[model samples]
Target: MRKALALSLCAVLLGGCASNPADRDISGTWINQVAIDAAAKGGPLREALQAYGPNLEWDVNTKAAQARYTNGFENVEGKLLGEKPGAWAVDFYGSSATELKRDGKQLSQAASENEPEQVFDRAVIPVPEGAPIGASFERALYSAYMGGSWQVVSGNGEGNTVQFQADGQVTGLPGADRYALCLAGDCASMSGGNDSIWLQQGGQGNSWIFARKGKTLEIFQSVNTALADEMPSYTAGDRKWLLEKQ
Candidate 1:
């Protein structure tokens, strides 16, 4: 019973943050900014976030919060337990509760005595549009196959590194911060049953597609998504793009 209670506590805590009062409503989209910035500089936390997937996001409403991950999302409806010394206490499962404190656009969650508090900020979330057919399965495969570090083999930025996260987050890729299994509604027919991935500058910036081999990734400049026939290939000169799993 104690183990089950502990698991329930973890589930509720990971679910998200919540609050009431219009002036202090902790509603909207929230992302772990600290984890993201730390992951970019490379360290133990980076590796951990990479393995855990960096696109962790939360959608908090007045009385509920939803935590989104690569595999999926979980929602936890909170009940107003009571008022704490400096925050609002919300109970998710019996005695397991989280305290929420909101200030402006930022929301802070009080942690246990040994754990550091977590902070989240209000932010806009980009919507992925034109999802291709079989995107779910393709996304799952992409997440499973691309979750690791890759070393650039022959690109202009040789010796650099890139990490493909299961949650669509990409790190150490020049001009790209996110990735997708398929976007622009053109990947299904273009892939020809082969594994492919897309790298985007920002969520809405220019994107390039790459075909994946066993342990190698190759990008063709001419096959960009801007044009219908655009597909990445092993081109010469500056367009020579390749990555090998490290």
Candidate 2:
């Protein structure tokens, strides 16, 4: 009887294992409609998205993940860990782990312990791959080129200091604490192709445009802010402020 009981227990365990669902494969570009919708209603994130353009795309595969923002110039990569529980997790090295729960065609991420979950929908249309040279402008390249303390080299804000943080925060630049770079655009040209780095201080309708360079940062204050309505344009003459990485 004891031998028969052991056999029954082993069968039950095997049955439970067989009933478990297979690990899901989440590999595609995801657009954050939750953030976009929230921005349309008005908020700090909205203002930032407006200035930077709401084109944040998450591209992931079985092993790697990337957060492409503002025309894909500001790109951040994370490691794609296999599915855990019912969700797939992306580990951003030392920063954070983003767990995405898939439901049909949508993936949802909890905004916080209390806030409503943010939703990401798989993109039917993917972001363009950009120019042939685009591959050279990865996040690591830009981070190494721009990250750290900087001092105004020659232009308007000469002698002033600023910082380009690894986490996207900008320090010491007046009326701005965050930055986004736009290098390419979608087929519709709705979000990017501005070829400018946008900076937002706080509140709606307030922003700054800076031309990105190798070691120097150029600010174009004279450029008309009204251009935010259409394609933004700025000439070399508009750039009078500069900062050199220290």
Candidate 3:
């Protein structure tokens, strides 16, 4: 495989580098360009997919965000995003350090020119040897990168920030009909201060409070109604859910 040798080198570099939730610094958007490049045959990631972001938009194939630790390694043991598993019972790793473009969301860590090349393992990925590195590969990589990624987001350490990632776009509940239609293909908003953001699938009733603790984003959903589960339940968590970003 074109990237197999690259993957080996990345592992050698990342040895003994367990991530500290305190060391993560993912503010905006980040991408595994290796994965992204492998996926696109049409054009650049955003142009090929017709997606852009300040509030980055990602699909099953596109990783919406990531966290770059000071040591350049991200661990995805219990994260809510991206879920993929394969041979070797692998918990993957990437450069803890990364550079983001002023305009593009693609990450520039471990690129071909970097001191230590950016690479990942095919063996860690549970796919048939040499699966076509296309759309399916991108989505698979997303699950791999994000699923095991982290529940941490970068912040000012003020512990007053609120960052929530929609599990299914729009709260998907019975009351989200009023609060900004945040869907999988679109964008959403976050609130600040003592104010509670109104979220629901219908006439806006589910109130939510957000807080940041170091690398973790916490959402306390004040579900005054019974439509909670349908209202954007985490793919695998609860109301007092932990969030991640990069």
Candidate 4:
């Protein structure tokens, strides 16, 4: 604790006031709060970072960060999560999806009238033989609502078709914002019928909640415990997917 304080103070005095990227961690959201905060308060580092004052979001599972720049349309935008202060500049556009694990034949969670749910056998979410899974599956739905050009950066995970535009943006995908990242470390399974996935985040001093259902997956979020966004973390929401093996 003392060492961290000293480092912060030394950097501030040096007139650079920056954290090293090599030592940065991703345990929370992508925003470099330490640096951005300094900038927002009109410190020496404000020019380069420009005070990240957008509706920020990200996926902890994939470590992808998104920043919604509102120059014109409020449809949402994407940007890579930065590692440190000085490196916190917009690279092209980027986003990410969340992930899962495996358990047995009991309802992973309960479904309520307010929250719809579905159940899969064993612990595998079945997608069409050629659909998508794992990281690839994550790609199809990641920060999709927070706009950006979507690209299938890797291979197939669970498998379902991901139709893309000539420019690589996804089309005819699930509901616009139907996705989630399990707040509890490495999640394994999701149950069905009014059953929703869980995500816990309260970065902006307000707890946000939302829900969506895909043709195969459904996601929603509801919680009271406020979460912080100091590292690579995610907000509260749900992501429901299928497990039909092709």
User: Which number leads on lDDT?
Assistant: 1
Q: lDDT of all the models against the reference?
A: 0.53, 0.53, 0.32, 0.29
Off by over 4 Å in 2: 1-142, 154-157, 186-194, 204-209, 222-237
Encode model 4's per-residue lDDT on 139-200: one tens digit a residue: 32232321332222222332443442221234433332233432112231122112223222
Task: Quote each prediction's TM-score.
Answer: 0.39, 0.38, 0.19, 0.16
Tens-digit lDDT string for candidate 1 (1-246): 999999999988876554335656665556555444443333232233334332344455555442221212233455655445546666666656667777667777667553356765554433346542223323333444576788988876788888886557878777778876542134434543333455677466543445555577776553433354656432112345788887
Model 4: residues with Cα > 4 Å off, grouped in runs:
1-133, 145-179, 182-191, 194-210, 213-246
Please give the RMSD of candidate 1 to the true structure: 15.6
Any runs in candidate 3 off by more than 4 Å, and if so which? Answer: 1-184, 187-214, 222-239, 242-246
At residue 89, give the lDDT of candidate 2: 71
Better of 3 and 4 by TM-score: 3
**Predicted structure 2: clash tally:** 0
Residues 62-146, candidate 3: write the lDDT tens digits. Answer: 1333332211111232111332221111112542332322222232233223234333222222434443323233334334222
Clashes of each: 4, 0, 21, 38
Better of 1 and 3 by TM-score: 1
Measured on C-alpha atoms, candidate 2 has an lDDT of 0.53
Question: Could you give candidate 2's per-residue lDDT for residues 1-246 as a string of tens digits?
Answer: 999999999999999886234335456666655444443332233243344333345566764444332224346567766777777776667866667667777766645443345566665432236522123222322354356678978664578788876445677766677775443443113322233555776643233455445556666653443365766444323565678766
Candidates ranked, most accurate by lDDT first? 1, 2, 3, 4
